[model samples]
Target: MSGKVFLAGAAGAVGAALTPLLVESGYEVYGTTRRLERMDAIRAAGARPVLVDIFDRERLANAIDCIAPMIVVHQLTDLPPGLDPTRMSDAVSRNARIRGEGTANLVSAALAAGCECVVAQSIAWAYAAGAKPYTESQPLDLGSEGARAVTVVGVAALERWVLGVNETGGVGTVLRYGNLYGPGTGRDTPQGASPLHVEAAAWAALLAVQHMKGGAFNVAEDEAEVTSEKAKREFGWLPDMRLPAQAAQ
Candidate 1:
């Protein structure tokens, strides 16, 4: 099942973790990054670097069209280091825009390229107050206010756009990752409910791309806040899995 893969946000935490896995699995990867400085890092991970902002529809479309990958992976995000409380007000809006508009653009480019599958990053903590452990069937917290509302709305848009690819004969898989920690995430230890390591999140995306399954799955630790049974059973994902030291760099 190896073929070309277009990875968005290649310089990001999860993206950096996922790139080597894709290459080692025999997929030719083209990773996207907005910064010229990160190109070498993507190359080091064995993926060709593509410098294009997700908001630039023309360049994004052109890049994807030229690559014409079999799968598209979206690991894009916008958040402050350590999720500093002081900067969160503005960061929340920016992050929402990334999840909403950025995801929309990526999906559009993917569909235009006739990609077979699209694997996207989402969050596991967005579920509304409900049972202790939330599942993929659980509804998102759409009725929240202020920052929470903004985040939920953006998440909804992202999931909708990604899942809608199925209507056009393409597979769409969303991994609802829990609060991430570990290298490059600015946290060395787990924090918050359903804590997940960055490597595990990356592995989940790889599994989705390999399985080419459509629908959402919660990618998180075996905790009470969210249930990861779906992902474990469907994708054989291991929440504690970490990338090999050399690959993680």
Candidate 2:
């Protein structure tokens, strides 16, 4: 908590939820955003904002090196606001690129800066159709077609790079999060095969930074498709957590 934390995609839904927690927990938080206009929001959340594109390897690496954070949290995504149906196809491709090429760039940058121990965001719905409650060990839906295949491939790439970082003295922890729904995420209530509150998703990343042992953990509610028991046992992450409506008086 004393050291700095480099948060990628700090203006994102989960990032917006996470920045405040990191600041309150005593970490020097450095957050990234591509849009200059969003810097104020990052600052309001108590994080030093850096403007950089995740796709720009050189710039991102420079940003990371400049901050020299001890922990890196990957929460980048390219989804359209509210997941507009008209924009979903394009967003899917962009999001896939983020999970694949973008993750590679981030990992390279983190390693160069001697910053190990990454807690990355991934989805819980990518598991193949085999069991009722999919565990972390289940194979991804690699054989699927169309958009689902694109998603699975991207998720697989991201996980591989994150976990493989441990081979070179760095540790990678993957939180296979369920569909995030909460304030700032456009969903005030749960929706999807496995719903998760955005606050709980952010909390899971925070817990992983301090307690996780560098592997995949399903972060979801008590859903039928995915199980979060591992995260509960390992990181004490509860899917029911939500941001308080009012500050403590």
Candidate 3:
């Protein structure tokens, strides 16, 4: 909880919720945003702001090297605001690229920086269609057509790269979060399948970074779509938690 922690995608919804948590937890937080305009927001959240694109391997590596963080958090995504239906197809493709290629770059950067652990964001709804409450061991829906197929493939690649890095000495933890709602995210209340608060999603990442044992964990409410018992037992995490009033703004 007291290391120099580097957070990728730190201007995104969950990232915005997480920055203050990391700072409050006494971590020397370095938050990243691709847009230079977001540096002030990151800084205001009590983190050192870094501007680096996840697609730019060299810049990301340099940023990580400069920060020398012990923990690296991957929250990168390219989805449009409110998940605009008209733009969803393009967003899916872009987001998949972020998951696949962006994840590769982040892993390489973390490894080069000698990071001890990496905590990454993933989705809970990617499981194959047979289960009620899917666990971490369930297979992803790899055979689906169109957008789902793209997402599943991208997710598989991201998980493989992250978990594989553990063999070389860096521990990897993946938090498969349910659909996020709450502040900064478009939804203020639960809406879709396995609805999760954005602050809860951020809390899961914080728990994963602090206490995970190098494997995937489902992070959701006590609903039937996904199970978060493992995260609760292992990290003592609770999904109902919210950020402070100031941070939520």
Candidate 4:
């Protein structure tokens, strides 16, 4: 029940937004990145930055130990610049591995550190074909083939790790965010499946630490592929998230 957070991928878009929120929420936040140079802004946002690669299991675990956080947020991804779709074929594979192997490493660290809660970032488009606006109870298309199959494997692995985690120390809440948009985000609303603003996604993570139930909730607008009613009812997830007026200036 202590207010300490270990945040991975702290230099990324969602992490940047979340850092300030964690501080404002009265939680002591520890942020991590692969490069110390990328962490200055995170420090400015009131997080103690630790530079280390998430793929390095020992290094990641040691960093978690040093931080001694009660909560861990897994938002790690290896997206390249410009949100370029041209290179998606390659990026998709890489991202899948992160969701699979990377998630396992994070889960292990969480277990070792005896963290209480784990809130992870996941995609909303992986639900198997159903009526529409797929619910959390719906099945994921893990049986997909080709590149789509590869993507599903990653998504399933990430979620499995996040939701399958035990609740003794803490529970893992998998927030299946819609395609992210808004400030500093790459994919716009019209371009992806059940798109949500980046600010909203960060807000979901912030609220997850405080109010989310330990389960999977879709966080997105009322798009055709997924439904966020659970998040709306449970964590007050806002698909229509926005920037504050002063910050928008």
Candidate 5:
């Protein structure tokens, strides 16, 4: 398998943390961001950043084709920085669009580029209200309120389009990450099961590139219903997969 990876949303919270890991893993990364300023930092991390938006189908397809990557990892989202809930209603609507419409454009671009594998980030907390910790096969709760309803619908769309890809050479890998925090993200630790640090999230994406396969795996700590047994058994993924915390010192 080729060691080249196309990391869409290369400047995101998870993307920022993942970039260093990609460089260290010796993968030629073609990262994308909507802004040019983000390219400088990405370049510093040994990535070739392409300034393009996921919503632009033509440009997006061209960018991917130019890279000719065997693997595509998507961590795109429209969450506001700091995640203030003052205007959460508006934020939810916009984020939902990213999960739904934005993801659709990515699928089209990946298919047009003849990319074989796609791995994307999905929320773990979007499962239905029945079980304490929802599994991958469980359905999402669509009967939610104003903002939550949009969130569930958007998540459902993103997952469907990613996993629905079928062809002679096409496979989708969805990594359902738990509540992300720590390093570059504002919330260092928040209340949630399956909590994952940004560093671990990055590691999981790299693992996907290393092992190209189809399946949804929960990427999170071994807290309650949030387990990564599938990921651990399949791709050797670990929730605490990080460099030493003292690396900061």
Candidate 6:
């Protein structure tokens, strides 16, 4: 409970919400951001700020090596604020790259640093078309076309890299989060098929860090799109969970 934790994408929505939780739970957190302007925000959230791009393998590896955290959390993404419609095409491609290449670099660095566990972010809406509620065992929509295809492919790669690390004696937990809303996210109310509050998503990541179990879990509200029962039973997560007002600040 009192070890080092390296959080990638510490300036992000979920990262911002999860940082204080990690700190309060007794972890020494080192958080990464690509922009110098975001460094203070990370520090304000109770973590030491580390400026390193996820795509910069050498620099990222060096940063993780210096910290030698017991746990590494992957919450990186490349989406624009509010998910602007006009820029979605470009955002999707960039985000796909983040999920693909960025994840590879992070897992590699985590392994090199001898991390005991890694918890990564994924999406719940990528399940292949079929049933009303998809389970973790369901296949991703790998055969889809256009933007969705790009996303699914990237999700698959990220999941493979994250889960495959378990074979090396490290625990890998992937949380397939639903469409996130709430603070830091553009939407104040729920949005998308399986809407999830940003704080609840952050809470799930904290649970994953605490659980140290390897496998995927759908983290979302009770909805037809996906089932979050696994996370609820395993991690005691609740979709309604939210950070206290002070902690949120």
Q: Which candidate leads in TM-score?
A: 6
lDDT of 6: 0.93
Pitting candidate 1 against candidate 4, the one with the higher lDDT is 1
Candidate 1 lDDT at 96 equals 90
| RMSD in angstroms between candidate 4 and the native structure over all alpha carbons | 1.9
Better candidate number, 3 or 4, judged by lDDT: 3
Provide the TM-score for each candidate, comma-separated.
0.98, 0.96, 0.97, 0.93, 0.92, 0.98
| Per-model CA lDDT versus the true structure | 0.92, 0.89, 0.88, 0.82, 0.80, 0.93
Clash totals in order = 0, 0, 0, 2, 0, 0
**Better by lDDT, candidate 4 or 2:** 2
For each of the candidates, the C-alpha root-mean-square deviation to the true structure, in angstroms, is: 1.0, 1.6, 1.1, 1.9, 2.1, 0.8
Error of 2 at 158 (Å): 0.6
- Say which candidate scores most in lDDT: 6
Model 2 per-residue lDDT tens digits across residues 104-142: 999889989989688899999999999778999999999
Flag regions of model 4 displaced more than 4 Å: 167-169, 188-190, 243-249
Candidate 2 lDDT score relative to the true structure:
0.89
Q: What is the lDDT of residue 188 in candidate 6?
A: 91
Where's the lowest-lDDT run of ten residues in candidate 6? 79-88
Candidate 5 lDDT, 118-163, residue by residue in tens: 8899888877777656677777777877678889998888888888
Better of 1 and 5 by lDDT: 1
Put down candidate 1 lDDT per residue, 52-89, tens digits, no spaces. Answer: 99999999999999999999999998778877889889
